[model samples]
Target chain A: MSTSPVTARLDRGVPRFGGFKLAIVRLEIRRQLRNRRTVFFTVAFPVFFFLIFGLNNAYASDPIGRGNESAFIMISMALYGTVLATSNGGATVSVERLSGWSRQLRITPLQPSAYIAIKMATSLVLGLVAILSVYIVAAFTHKPSMPLGLWFATGAAIWIGSLLFTAFGLFIGYLLPSENVMQLIGFALMLFSFGGGLFIPLSQFSHPLRVLATYTPLYGLNQLVHYPLVQGSFNWSWLSNLVSWLIIFTVGATWRFKRDTARV
Target chain B: MAERDVVPRTPPALELKGVRKDFGDVHAVRGIDLRIEPGEIVAFLGPNGAGKTTTIDMMLGLSVPSAGTVSVYGRTPLDAVRLGLVSAVMQSGGLLKDLTVAETVEYTAHLFTGARPVDEVMERAGISLIADRLVAKCSGGEQQRLRFAMALLPDPDLLLLDEPTQGMDVEGRRAFWKAIRHDAQAGRTIVFATHYLDEADAYADRVVLIREGEIVADGSAAEVKALASGRAVRATLFGADQATLRALPGVDHVEVHANSILLHCADSDAVARYLLTQTNAKDIEITARALEDAFVALTGSHARDESVQSNADEVLR
Candidate 1:
């Protein structure tokens, strides 16, 4: 056997960051965008909810916080959109796991950290798209009355806060089988959104339910994102909730990923 | 100067020392010890459930062994793989169904440090024409070729193909092997697992026959074929005593069916000559035992053991 021109120049060093990792993120984004179901649920659903819930005059007539009720609903809907986008993006890992793509990746030069980074990066990108789309719709139609800085701050907060759900999605994607992943994620998302005051204000919940709502994973993210528009100050509970859930989900995701990839 | 002098030789391409794998109660691979030298094209010849895929998975570091070690080029399997020293075309379920052929190739190419140019690899795999086709729309053979192209991306020194041509048509299989042969000629150490004896015989420099998770035979095609108790000579002879024919030189066993005598012989040529000159034998036929028969003969012992265990249970009951 003789060496070929291609084999002669084989590079043996470990690759630097940003080459293959960025390619993986780009490919993941392209593939996710191609899935109409993902787009509809992540981007379109929250916008649709905003149109239905935000158009009413009752919330606008009654001032709830720093802004009016329309502003509150808009921020909640955007947060919901980001949550959906990031969670769905993370959940796609279940399909990839089932398809043995993770196994294929294990045999490659690409580091496991790089693969996780790619997934997180992709989820963040999709979350950005979801947040911006909802915010754009609200800016045009609902015209929620708020200072321009607060609006951008709220959007940034929601986008950043969705990282917890992204980790949550990763935890479940690696923990659950592919067949049960979407159903579980959908049910969990509905419950979290309701409890977190994304769909309904926590003030409207019964005393016991409102207590439980504070403990839900999304509660902290919801409060954090709405703080700028509603409170204009940080709530210690909101910061603690977000930090605690982030740590839990990140640890769970890392453990599950290691266990899943280590299996024969 | 010789080519070997021009380049320093590396360690063995692959080495498995007392490798074992267990899936709960079922021991998929009992213990396998193998050393494959660099530039050797070895075929892991085995039937389904004979641990070929498991062995390949362990070698590729897709699965960790229950015990012992597997190394490629003296590095741990995973380390070797990460260094782009080894690559594999797995049997199935490794590909993304959504990506187009070209996208898949390009995407995988980007994951490696020194992948071959995408278009060159596509052309080499004979998938250039179908580059625009979605992976889900490609045929089984096309998907295999796509996997082949991915394996070639890193220009890996050692290529592991797990039942690479499992579902290909005859022509597709021929072309697949042609491309593999091209790789082999370019100094790649190729290890492919296959149930097809002819594939091992034709394409591999050495054939390692595995049965019930252990290597039953390891040698060249002819050498492995010789592991089965030799060839059979059939001849028409009237009123010939089976006992007398069984006692002939080179003959191991004899079966008489009507007027024809079947002699299982270590040396079929000697038996044939004896049958032609001394005996009133006619219409003689000598057939070497096919690898299929050898495989059955090798694995049949397990079936026999199970039956014996069942018989003992019945007696106890």
Candidate 2:
């Protein structure tokens, strides 16, 4: 019961992110890919939606910015896809947590910070696949047009933006019961998609509804990602909204995780 | 004496001082004190709901103690875990059904700083043959072995196994113990919980019996067996004399029922030998004291309720 040895060990600080953490993230991604059903639905559904909604002659003709209406819709669909995929990716933790796998991990030397990093990294990979699949389909169908740099930015923005929902997914996984978490995550993401003006344009909504959309979790990320295609003025409030929600979600997930492990 | 000042001696592998755990109204563990040295195979022998799992959980830092302290080596249980000095094979449900056995081991290896090679642990755990199979496709026994393989990845100093051979077949159980015994010979500490008396008696260097949230007995297997020492030798000897049966060495009591006689003694083997050789005894039956008797001996009595006794039934089985 001496404190000296502990202090000595503490002097040799353990790295939070290293080969071990990356290895877990890599393995997690591989495991997610092996679930063919989830892969097929998350990757294919968004592309399928983009084709159905954005491939019309009218959408291709109406110019919104440097691209056309089809380009704007394509970006929207990509954001929607990545949100679903990333949330689903993080939501799978609910099952893992319940299955005693988390309990198994509890006894190991893996630090809690490394675990969160692994989850976020793996979920971002899933989000990348989703958004890329949508973009590929859109390009193949000649549904959207933008500068080459904007296309890169659009994909990067949506992929990075998906981290918010990934943290939300992890939060929900630790908070909600595993059985209904997936269905619940899917439904909640759909509402966020609509409220954030991904499915319907915020410009068309009444001023009151538009103002309310600013407070929705997805609204900031949604508008900011569109800037790559729509080419609009930078809105500082958008960044603030996204950053605040991300902190809220990330903190919530960590809190729930600590609480879960304490009593588990 | 001069050398002792220059170098610190190793601490006990595990030390618990008045550890207690409570789940609201349920006192899962109540003030257990135990010290295990390195390389000792100690079995936490108990029936269901006897606080075996609760104590193990606290040892692994999976749950905090309601009171008291658990030290592994020289630090707290959680510190021991963080230092990668301890590992455990949990009772159940710590596997991903989708991952193959090999992937499971490999994935877990990534959590430790200098974990043993995946193939080495898998082969040592006797799970190499089923490495390619998905965990979902494995039998209960195979899954348990997979868990063992994962636990071995860290090459921990103290290994805790909770109901390790619960679902294993005879062959799997044999292989599991073979691996465990080999590790024991290598000077690693091991603590396992098992309801099977033979597992504790045959494998553990020491047996710590828990019942109704308390340590009822703690000693060598033979010493604990001595606590409930009497056995019976019953045989049909055709008009056996009660006076002759009572005169046998180690015989504590003798009961004659017409043509048959029952000898209750500390040594049943000698009594049986006498019945088979010295007398015309047929259909001889020698029975050792049951685990239930050991429980009764340690605790003075057992549960009167049918439900609680059913848990004891599992111990007998």
Best by DockQ: 1
Say what the interface RMSD of candidate 1 is.
5.9
For model 2, state the Cα shift of residue B165 in Å.
1.7
lDDT by residue (B52-169, candidate 1, tens digit) is 9999989988788999999887777877777788999998877788888999998888887777899998998889999999899999889999999999998888999999998788
Q: Where does candidate 2 stray beyond 4 Å? A: A1-20, A203-214, A232-237, B1-7, B229-317
RMSD of 2: 8.7
Put down candidate 1 lDDT per residue, A1-264, tens digits, no spaces.
223222333458667773447777888899889888788888899999988888787666467566777788888988887888888878878988898877777778877777778888999999999989888998898557778888889888888889898899999998885856866887899999998999988899999999989989999889888887677557799889889999999999999988876656
Which candidate tops lDDT? 1
Model 1 has fnat of 0.64
After superposition, the stretches of candidate 1 with alpha carbons farther than 4 Å from their true spots are: A1-11, A18-20, A61-64, A232-234, B1-8, B229-264, B267-317
Write down the worst ten-residue block by lDDT for model 1 chain B: B1-10
Would you estimate the TM-scores of all the predictions?
0.83, 0.81
